[model samples]
Target: MLLDFGCGPGRVAGHAGRALGMRIIGVDASPDMLALAREEGTPGAEYHLVADGRVGGLADACADAAMCNHVLASLPDERTVLEVFTEIHRLLRPGAPFALLTTDPACAGIEYASLRVGEPGVSYGPGEAMPVRLRRTDGTWQSVRNHAWPVETFPPLLEGVGFTDVAQHHPTPDEAVGVADPEHVRSRDWSAERLRPPLVVTTAVKR
Candidate 1:
């Protein structure tokens, strides 16, 4: 089975299950996201809640691969990220692949200035604690707060956690198509010019 680590709304897992026929187990901290995923009726997918953003709930050596896409930045700390990686290491057999797709903060020039969301005075930024609410498939709402980390820090952290053959690939501008939001095309166009370099995709194996 493949683990859709930090699966949000099960979009990728659903696609993989239907198109690739992979048996998928999705784990996310958000119940709302999990409910939404389940409501999608994604065949061959199971959902699990990781309240602590760690994989202590999973059985050891139970998965062939794990995919974590755009989930790293939402985590709280390097230690937590490391713990999750180690847990993934424990759950996968030797040589199992861990494919991670995370944002390169440089790609967006993410500044940590205080910003408002939903409310007029609520503020959040990198290293700040904040709650995020997501709508579930069951029409319920769930909130979660995550710590953010930079892209450059991942390689050393992965290597420190007993993963080897680490490689980070930057998706070319052409490859970035279909990845951005349709409604945000104008925003992407402006940001594409501002941040011309590619974003990173890193993969490694448990050694």
Candidate 2:
């Protein structure tokens, strides 16, 4: 089975279970998000609540693989981020792959089609507070306060928690050609995206 660590609203869990044909165990701390996930139930997927930083009734090394999507930026500090990573580490067996998706902390000021991080020409320190703006489909923008965790910090944290071969990559717009919507890729002028990619994918193996 695969674990969708911090699977808010089941977007990643449901899509992953459907696209990859894997049995998913989605765990989250929010009751409201869990309720939404249950409402939009994915086939061959189960939802659970994370209480006191632990997913209840789950055994260690039960998941073959896991993924966390953009969950770290919401955390207050590196210690809390490590705590979450450690929990995810416990769920996977030896050599299991953990793919983490996050916003690149350095990709601030640039306005992408969907989101913008921090203010223009401003840089944030590790675990520093910043304002993030996300563009909705209706052309509306939503502002949220988020913590910035630089890309460099993840490898050490992941390694400290028994994860090896940790690697981080900033994905450019060109890389999304095949997987993402063709129309979306074709329609937008992605100069800023090509120049400063906003998304980072960190991969590691449980050791």
**Which TM-score value belongs to model 1?**
0.71
- The digit string of per-residue lDDT tens for model 1 on 53-170 reads 4654678888888888867656666677887787777777888899887544443323211211222344334444444444454656665554445556778988998999999887
- For model 2, give the 10-residue run with minimal summed lDDT: 11-20
**Quality of model 2 by C-alpha lDDT:** 0.89
Q: In model 2, which residue pairs have backbone atoms overlapping below 3 Å?
A: none
Question: What are the RMSDs of all candidates, in order?
Answer: 6.4, 1.2
Q: Could you tell me how far off, in angstroms, the CA of residue 5 lies in candidate 1 after the best superposition?
A: 1.0
Off by over 4 Å in 2: none
Task: Give the C-alpha lDDT of model 1.
Answer: 0.68
lDDT of model 2 at residue 2?
85
